[model samples]
Target: MRDALVKYGFIAVTVVLFVFFAATEPAFAQSSTMFSMLKFASVTAILGLGVTFTMVVGGLDLSIGATAGLAVQLAAMTMVFYNLTGPTAVAAVLLGGVLVGLANAVLIVVFKIPDLLATLGMMFVIQGAKLIPVSGQSVSSGMVLRDGSVAPGRFTPDFLLIDRGFVGPVPLPVVIMLVLVVVSWFVLSRTSAGRILYAIGANPEAARLAGVRVGLYRGLAYVISGLFASVGGLILVSRIGQGDVNAGASSLLEAVAVALVGTSVLGLARPNAWGTLLGALLVAIVLTGLTMKGFQYYHQDTAKGFVLIVALLFSFTLSRRKVRYTPAT
Candidate 1:
């Protein structure tokens, strides 16, 4: 009972804070504000889910933020330069993300490059590559077709709803986020591949002895991470109606923070979908609360650092208790 409480303490704290804020602030509990929060959560949750994959394989993909940014650039450029439809542009961007993921996998698994160094290098590569098409200019939404003519912006009301439009009472982005959460949960918890990943993270040598293909699984993990980033990038473009070169920079740190928070929740001890969801929600709630209070924006960064520190402390404390209670060898 005490152990369970320790594991879920953060959730309780978040709930309490949310209720308190909703009661105290007039605008905080508005339906529009709630929808906005969910929209923000969707972007961060997608990024966190991707980070979870790399962490499960005992690696980190620092390039996810950059990859997502590059994906947005690719999607926009496709529509602008190649005259591709939205669906086609999205498909091509996702495939590009997968190829980048595969490249990262090769660098780490085949070339013996460290995951951190390899991903960091890939981060720069993607960042620089994203600039090649626009030559450092933000690709205007009003782009010309390949036949040497300006293409007027297509303003389909139904298409706009995918990001900004809502279904009855729920926002479309929120629904998409929920669907992704379920799919990611199934992939990580119910699949044989998922178990293999946990095994690798816990002990790669032991997993190899058990006949698991460590290298292949590690590579696949990166690819999954990149794919998730692509989804996030698409949703982001939809929400803003345009993509920014700097959109992905903040996501890298936010994703890592959310993943680490998941590690501390419910004694999950491994990367988990529900835990990641809760973690992202917690961060969103904190930022919302702080912003509502008119706190300086810079203090939000301090708050994030504090949250991470506390979460790590809680994780270490719980881990020590488990070790101490285990039967003697």
Candidate 2:
């Protein structure tokens, strides 16, 4: 009974919270409002998946947000500045993602720098470097460039459809998010590669002794993290249709928070894609509810922080209890 509660407590809390919000804010219960909320949450969920992969391998990926920012910026620059085709722009940005992943892998696995510090430094640097291409301006249609010339190209319709187009009433990004979750879950839960990665996270020395290539797997995890972050960025830019400088910065906290929150989900005591999605949904619901209650943007972080703390405590306490009550081998 206790084990079940630890595993399923979030479901109950999520229901209770939904009920409370629905009761307090009628607007939140509307179908359109729900769609909007889900759409907003999808980006965070996507990024959280990437973060979860890194966390599953016992590493942090602080640069995912910046990586995403760079992806969108480069894509926008290709389309609007260089007058490239949509596919070409997308290809360029995806390549950028791979490169960013390689950089993170080199720093962490090759140079042996701490994950937190390496990604953190990359975050600041990439976030700043992104400005150089746009001449420190946001990329929007008809926006004057640094040279006082108007941007000739706009977001192509095909690129815009990546996020905005629907397939049988489902938002594209939501569908993509679901697909990624399935893929991530499949890879992590089913594949030998995924098992080894998890093993390394749990016990690196043991994994190494068992012939696992720890360095290679560690680097691979970071590469995936970087790639997914870029995918998230691509989705966000496709939806918004502009390269807003601070958009990526805002996502960093939400992505990490939701990813960490996933760790305690279902008493799994590890990072998982479903938990990350659930965490993102929980945050989205709370924020939507708060917004209906007239919560200001500046103060919304407090509520988010509180939710994160409660989740951490819940997971930590249950984890300890699980160990205490476990039977000896």
Candidate 3:
């Protein structure tokens, strides 16, 4: 009974919550509302995937949100300031993500800094550095530049399609999120490299002794994380059609919370892509339901925190009992 509860309880609770919201709020039952919730979850889930990759390597990345914010700024600058095309903006942000990830690898793997501290420092650096080009102003169409000239470009229609266009009946962002989650799940759960990564996470020294390139794989994890963050940022830029200086400010907390909550999902007790998606869904439901129920914006955070705590408690406290078995004599 305990094991069954540990495995299925979270899913059951989520379903119950969904049903409750649908029953009470007439608007929540609408198809548009459902898609809107999924679209919101898509970005959060992508950011969570970034954190998940690092977590699998037994490391934490505090810089994911800042890296994403930098992507947002870079994409906007590419299109709105440099008068470049959407593809150029996409390429710019992806390159920026890789560079940030590489720098993190250098700091942590080569320079021997603690992962948390290194990423935390990087977060601050990125947050500050992204503001330098525009003199701390948000980037948008027709914004005045430093030399008293208005920016000549705006977000191209092609770029806006990334977030706005629908494939059949599904939103593009949601489809992207689903594809990423599926790919990530396959890579982490079905491949030899994935096994090696888990082995390293379990015991780095042991994995090193077993002929695994511990440092290399760990570095790769950070790079993947950075790439995911950049993608999330690009999606955000497409959605908003401009770069807000405050973009990605809330991403860190939301992503971290999603990742943490994912660990215990389905009793897996590990960071996983499916679990991350589920966690994102749970959070989206809570926040959207509260909004429809007339709850204040500030109270939404508290509700999210509460759900995370409960999920974790079930994962850690209730699922840790030992099962004793006698070996054949």
Candidate 4:
């Protein structure tokens, strides 16, 4: 029973909440509502996946939110300031993500800094540096520049389609999120490289002794994380059609929470894309249900905290009990 609880508890809780919401709010079961929930979870899921990569390599990226915010700013600037095309904006944002990831890799892998401290410092740098170009202003269509001239470009319709467009009634973001989940799941759960990452996480010295390039894989993890963050930020700007300075304000908290909750999913106790998706869905469901019940914005955080605590309990408490009592095979 304890083992089952450890493995299925989070999933069970998610289903219960979903059912409760559906029963109490008839609209919650509607296709539109479900899609909307998925859409909202998309960015959280992507960011969580990026964080998962870092976790797999025994590191945590505190700078993902800031990196994503930088993407948002870059994308917005490309279109709204430089009057560039949608494709160009995307290229620029993705490039920015790679650079940030490389910087983080250098800090942690080359400089021998602790992962948390390195990412934390990077987070601060990105948050401040992203503002310098716009002189600390959000990017939007026709915004006035520092030179006292009006910026002329608008978010191209093609760019907005990334957020608003749907494929056979499903939101594009949801589809994108699902695609990322599938690909990441395959990479982490099926491949030798994935196994190497887990090995590194479990024991870097042991992995190094086995002839694995520990630094290389660790650097790769951060790069993957950065790419994921960039995509998340790109989706955000596309959805809002502007670059809000605070675009990623809550992203760090939400991303980290989902990634942590994901560790408890299926009793994996490790970062996995499928678990991250479930975690994101759980958060989205809670937030959407609370909103439908007329709860204020701040209350959503409390609900997320409650869910996370329960997940941790199910993951750690029961697993310990199971290990303590089980007989040797």
Pairs with steric clashes in candidate 1: none
Q: By the lDDT metric, which is better: model 1 or model 3? A: 3
Quote each prediction's TM-score.
0.91, 0.94, 0.96, 0.96
For model 2, residues 19-80, the per-residue Cα lDDT tens digits are 99999888889988888888889989999998888887788888998999998898889888
lDDT of each: 0.79, 0.85, 0.89, 0.90
Clashes counted in candidate 1 amount to 0
How much is the lDDT of residue 306 in candidate 4? 96
* Residue-level lDDT tens digits of model 1 in 1-329: 65776677767777887898898887888988888888888888888888888888888889999988987777767765555677777788799889889999999999989888999999999999898767676555575544557755442344345678777788888888788888878987899998888778777888999999999999998999999888888887666665577768788999888888887777666678887788888787788888999999999899888877766666666554421111101
Compose the digit string of candidate 3's lDDT tens values, residues 171-276.
9999999999999999999999988877777778889999999889888988988999999999998998899888998899899889888887788877889988
Error (Å) of candidate 2 at residue 136 is 1.1
- How well is each residue in 126-181 modelled by candidate 4, as lDDT tens digits? 99999999889898888889889999888999998989999999999999999999
Mark the regions of model 3 whose C-alpha exceeds 4 Å error after superposition. Answer: 321-329
Model 4 steric clash pairs: none
Indicate the residue-level lDDT of 37 in model 2: 84
**Model 2: residues >4 Å from true position, as ranges?**
321-329
Instruction: State the number of backbone clashes in model 2.
Output: 0
**How do these models rank on TM-score, best leading?**
4, 3, 2, 1
